[model samples]
Each structure stands twice: as C-alpha cells, then as structure tokens.
Target: MPEPIKVLVTGAAGQIAYSLLYSVAKGDVFGKDQPIILVLLDITPMMEVLKGVVMELQDCALPLVQEMIPTDKIEEAFKDIDAALLVGAMPRRDGMERKDLLAANVKIFQEQGKALDHYAKKTVKVVVVGNPANTNAFICSKFAPSIPKENFSALTRLDQNRAQAQIAGRLNVPNNAVKNCIIWGNHSSTQFPDVSHATVTKNGVVQPVAEAVKDDHWLNNEFIKTVQNRGAAVIKARKLSSAMSAAKAICDHMRDWWFGTHEGEWVSMAVPSDGSYEIEQDLMYSFPVNIKNGKYTIVQGLKIDDNAREKMNVTMKELKEEREMALAACQE
Candidate 1:
C-alpha cells in the first residue's frame, strides 16, 4: 500500500465541508486504494460542532480514512499536509456588498496562507473554494511566496461543469460526450462559459458543440446567463447556497488535476496570469488548461471573438477591483 497522504480541510463544520469531508473519506477525491489522514479545521467557536462532524465520520467507519484530526488551530491543521482545501470564509449575507465580503474573506485567507507557508509541505497543492475565490486565492498565494504559484488554483470547475451539463442537455447527449468546455475569468456572474472548441460525440461520431446547438443567440444569452447565475438560481429554489454541487465540483477539479486530464480534453482552472491572452499580470484568471504528468499547462492559441472578449474583460475588471479592494484593506 502507498503511504497515506495528509489532507487539510478548513470550514470543516460548514455546509460545503460537511458534504466534502465524507466524500474525501470515501476516496471520492483521491483514489480508492489511497489512504488519507484528514485534518479538519474551523474557528474556535465552531469546534464543538466540528467535533460532532468528526464523530459522524468515525461512525461511517470508512476504511480509507486512516485517522482524523479536528482542530481550531491553523498551524496544526496545515502541518505537513499534502493537499489543502481552503474552503472556509465569510459568506455573503443579505445586504452585504461584494467589496465588504471580499475585505472580510481576504483577512481569513491571508492568515491561512501564511500558516500554510509556515507549516505545509512545499509540494502541497492548494485550492481556494471560498467566496471571491479568485482574489482570495491571489491573496493566499501572495503570502506563500515559498510555494510555487502554479501550485495554487481557485475553483472554476463548478462553472465548467455547469456549462458542460447545459450544453449536453441542449444537444440531447450524455454529459460525458461534451469535451473542452471552458469557463474563463472570475467565478462570479461575469464568468464566460465558452464552448467554441467543445465537441459532442454521437453514434461514434463527433461534432463541434456550436454546430450541435446551432443557435448563437441562446449560447450567447440564455446559456451564458444560466450558468453564470446558477448559484443564485440554486439559492432561490432551495433557500441555501449550493453546497453539495459545489463540493462535488471541488472533488472533480482536484481529481482531474491530480490524475491528469485525457488528451484533447481541457478544463477550466483559475491560476495566476502569466499574461496569457493579454491578461494583466498577478491576477488569478480562469483559463483552459490541460493536465498531464500531474502538471497543468494553459492551453494556447484559442481564438476569442469580440463578444467573448468583451465578456471576459467584464470579469477581469471585477477581479481587478476585488484585488484593489483587498490590497487596500490589507494595508490598513
């Protein structure tokens, strides 16, 4: 058997983490044969609730879970972790402005990032799953200067998964038949889900997604809007933010990244910009990425039309404003 890996999860008592921890224990994120030591962390006030979570995990008796550590200490949680799922953050409540939410969450991630830098293994893989994820990831990564920027990513797979499902449903094909769907820019409503290069397989044959849909109007307007506001739509229906789906998307994102994507397939990940597609430096922007040999390379040479460019710019502008707000607050 391979050596057990240590995985750290923040917000361990919260809705998303409640869904996520059980999944990880069941080897949903990692493989079945792999063993894991789960280190769960939350704020001190939540420790009692987190203890109940740990008890339930124990009751499940999952074989892959070798051990469980529940803590309110960030340093203890991050110690020697191989993977860190930074899911804990202040949620945007009713009447809360976006800038206010960003400011609040940035402080949380800033401290956690420093703790990871001080405690986590240098090779640790970090995914920021909290709100304002792109900028939260940016702030976290900035403090972890020792860790390579490429090792950091924000969650955009939820958007990508939403796009794939929408396209597959529209084309009357299985979800697996859709490939190369990309979610670009922020994880917010401004995100652009582009299927320009996507393909749908039918009866042992493949065609471009755009050809299958055959309606630019729907793709540009309704499909885009639906995927962009999916979280809000879920909240409207269920009276809660997306927890189960978001957790599942987090699993998919980490699994694809850890195992590698199949050739000719790409997924969206929010990584620091290296000036790809003329995006400014130091921003965490989502882009089409291919993973192989446990490394992600941004897919190159995709054509962006004027409309797509305009939408991408809108999201990018939001990220910039968020970054500015966060940086100013951090300086205060």
Candidate 2:
C-alpha cells in the first residue's frame, strides 16, 4: 500500500463533519487505493464529542483510515497535513447579519490559517466549507501568504450540484445527464446559477439545457431563486442546516479537484480570480473550471448575456463588501 496521506478536518464533531469523516474513510474523497490518516480538530469543549466520533470510526474498521488523531490543537491537527477542510464556523443565528457572521468567522479562520501556514505541507490543498465560505477562504488565504492562492477554494459545489439536480428534474433526465452547469459568484443567495451553456442527454441524444427545459420564464425566475434559497429551504424543512448533502458535495468537490474532471466537462469551484469575466483579482469567486493534472483553469470564452451579467454583478458587489469587512476585521 502507498503511504497514508494526512488529512485534517476542522469542526470534526459537527453534523457536516459527522457525514464527511465517514465518507473520507470509505475513500469517497480520496480514491479507494489511497490510504489516509485523519487528523480531527474541534474546540476544547467539543473534544469529548470528537473522541466519540473517532471511536465510531475505529468501530467501522475502514482499511483506508490508517490512523485517526482527534485534538483541540490547530498545530497538532495541521502538522504535515496534505489537505485540510475548514468546516467549523459560527453559524448565523436569528437576527445575525451577514457582516456580523463574517466578522465572527474571520477571527477563527485567521488563527487557523496561520497554523496551516506554519505547519502544513506547502502543497496542501485547503477547502473552506464554513458559512460565508468565499470570504472565509479569502481571509484564510490572506493569512497564509506562503501558500499559493490557487491552493485555497470555497465549497460552491453544493450550489452547483443543487443547480444540476434541479435542471435534470425539470428535464426528466438522470442527474449524470446534465453537464457544464455553473454556479457563479458568491455561495450566498446572491449566487447566479447559469445553465446558458449547459447540455442534457435524453434518449441517447444530447442537447442544450435551455432547449431541454423549454421554459425561459421558469429558468429566469423560479430556478435561480430556488437554487439561491435552497439552503434556507432545507433549514426550514429539516430544522437544521443541510448535513448529508453538504458533506456529499464537499466530497464531490474534492474528488473532482484531486482526480480531475472528465474530458470536455467542468465543475464549479470558488477559486482566486485572475480577472476572468472582469471579476477582481485575488477574490475567491465561483466560476466554471476544468481540472487536469491536479490544476484548474477557469473556463473561458462563454458569452455572458445581459441578464447573466446583471446577476454576476450583484453577487460580486456582495463579495466586495464582505472583503472590505474582512479587511477591517483583520486590521482590528
């Protein structure tokens, strides 16, 4: 067997982590042949809960999970880690504004980012899964200057998967039949789900998603709003934020990133922009990206209609405001 890769997961005792850890152990994130040593971290108060989680992993006897370390120490958890998932953050409660939540998470990511910079392998890939993920990712990357900006990304795949599923359902096709769906800009409600270039396969025939759905009115209004607000709808229905689907999306994101996307296919990731589509540089913004040889390139040359441009601007504006708030917080 190959040497076990050290994988660190923050917020190890939370609902999302609960689902994520098991999937990783089962080789859902990493390939089946690759072994992993999981380093699980949480706050001191949650150490006992983290221990219970470790015990359960032990009970499963998953061969891919070569070793498990549960700790409250960031340095200990991140030491020589190959990949880190920043999943723990203060969830927005009733009456909490976006800026308020961003402020609270900024402090957490800043400290954790420093630990990652000091202890993790320079090539470590970090995915920020916490709320206000795009901004949290930017804050973490800001503190970890030694790491390449390309090494950090936010989890926009959840939004992308939701968009794909919605499109497939509308066209009465299997989920795998949908390709090239893009979730652009922030992960918040201001996000834009673009199917303008997507294609769907039905009855052994492939065609543009717009052609398959045949309802521009629904696509423009209900589909975009539904994808944007799906998280809130889940919270309302489940009495808790989405756990399983979120974890699944994280796995999907990491898998595609590490394993590469299929030829001619792209996935959505919130990566540092290089001024593509006129987006500002250095912001972790969602774009359609194609991966190969463990590197990603933003998909280029797609025409952005006036409506899509309007939606993109709205989310970009929100992200810029959040970036300003994060900068102010860092200075404070």
Candidate 3:
C-alpha cells in the first residue's frame, strides 16, 4: 500500500462532520484503493465530544483509515495535511448582525490560514464549508500566500446540488439528468442559479433545462429564489441547518477536486476569481469550473444574457462588500 494521504476536518464534532467522516474513511471522497489518515480538530471544550466521534469511527473499523488523530491544536491538525475541510466557524446567533458574524469568523480563518501556511503541505487543497464561506476562503488565501490561490475553494457545491435537485424534481426526472447547473456569485440568497446554460437529459435526449421546464416566469423568479433560499427552507422544515446533504456536498466537492469532472460537465465551486465574468479579482466567487489532474480552471466563454449579467453583478457587489468588512475586522 502507498503512504496514506492526510486529510483534516476542523469542527470534527459538528453534525456535518459526523455525517462526513464515515464516508471519507470508507473512501467515498478519495478513491477506494487509496489509503488515508484522518486528522480531526475542534475547540478545546469540544475535545470530549470529538473523542466520542473518534471512538465511533474506530468502531466502524474502516480499512482505509490508517491512523486517526483527534486534537484541539490547530498546528497539529494542519501539519502536513494534504486536504482540509474547514467546517468550523462561529454560527450566527439570534439578533447578531452579519458584520458581527464576519468579524468573528475572520479571526478564526486568519489564524487557520497562518497554520496552513506554516505547517500544511504547499499542495494542500482547502474547502471552506462554514457560513460566509466565500469571504472566509478569501481571508484564508490571503494569509496562506504560499499555497496557490487555485488550491483554495469554498463550498458552493451545496448550492449547485440544491439547484440540480430542484430542476430534477420540477421535471420529475432523476437528479443525474441535470447538467451544468451554474451557481454564480456568493453562496447567499443573492446567488444566481443560472439554468440559462443548463440542460436536462430525458430518454437520452438532452434539452435545455429552460425548455424542459417551459416556465420562464417560474424559472426567472421562483426557481432562482428556491435554489438561493433552499438552506433556509431546509432549516425551517428540520429546525436545524442541513447536515446529511451538506456532508454529501462536501464529499462531492473534494472528490471532484481530487479526481476530475466529466467531459463537458462543470460544477459550481467558489474559487478565487481572476476577473472571470467581470467579477473582482481575488474575491472567492462561485463559477462553473472544470477540474483535471487535481487542478481547476474556471469554465470560460459562457454567454451571459442581460438578466444573468444583472443578477451576477448583485452577488459580486455583496462579495466585494464582504471582503471590505472582513479586512477591516482583521485590523481591529
């Protein structure tokens, strides 16, 4: 067997990590033939809960997990890690403003970024899954200058998955039938879920998703809002933020990054922008990206109609403002 790749999960005791770790240990994200070491990190107060999770993982007796280390030490968690799923961040509290939440998380990610720069492998692949993930990822990349910008991404895959499921449900087809569901801009409600470039395959005949749904009003308004607000809807129905689905999306995001997307297929990832679609450079913005050999290149030359352009600008503005706030917080 080859040497195991080290994967780290922060907030290892959290519900999403609870759902994710089992799948990862079973080779759901990385390939089944590959061996891996799991580094589980959380706050000191959560160490006991994290230990229970480690015990549960051991009970499963997963063969691929060569070693498991549960710790409250950031440096230990990040050291030599090949991949990081940054799931831990301050949750928004009742009556807390958005800026306040950003201020809290900026400090957390900034410190983690320094750890990654100082200890993690230069090739470490990072995906920020916490709330305000796009800005958080940008902050992390800012601090970890040695790690290539392309190596860092945020979890827009969940938003993409939600868009696909909504389309599939509307068309009464399998979720796999939807292709190229693009999530543009931030992960928040301002995101533009563009079916303008998406397609639905039914009976092996591929048709544009808009044509299949055949409801422009619904597509332009209801579908967009539904995809953008799906998280809130899940929270309303379950009285908790999504866990199982969020875990699945995290796995999918990492899997695609480790392997590669299929031919002519693209997925949403919030990667640092280099002025794609007029989005500000250095902002972590979601774009349809195609991956190959563990590297991602944003899909280019997609036609953005006037409507799509307008919506994209709104989300872009939000991210710009978020970056400004996060940077200002760092100064305080």
> Each model's C-alpha lDDT?
0.91, 0.93, 0.93
lDDT of 2 by residue, 1-332 (tens): 88999999999999999999999998988899999999999999999888899999999999898899999988799899999988999876544577888988999999988998899999999999988999999999999999999999999999999999999898888899999999999999999999999999999999999998889999999999999999888877877788899999999999999999999999999999999999999888999999998899999999998999999999999999999999899889
lDDT of 3 by residue, 242-305 (tens): 7899999999999999999999999999999999889889999999999999999999999988
Q: lDDT per residue, candidate 1, 212-281, as tens digits?
A: 8899999989999999989878877877778998999999999988899998889999999999888888
**Could you arrange the candidates by TM-score from highest to lowest?**
2, 3, 1
**In model 3, what is the error at residue 190, expressed in angstroms?**
0.7
Predicted candidate 1, C-alpha RMSD: 1.1
TM-score of each: 0.97, 0.98, 0.98
Task: Give the root-mean-square deviation of each candidate in angstroms.
Answer: 1.1, 0.9, 1.1
Cα misplacement distance, residue 124 of candidate 3 (Å): 0.4
Candidate 2 local Cα displacement, residue 154, angstroms: 0.2
Give the winner by TM-score: 1 or 3: 3
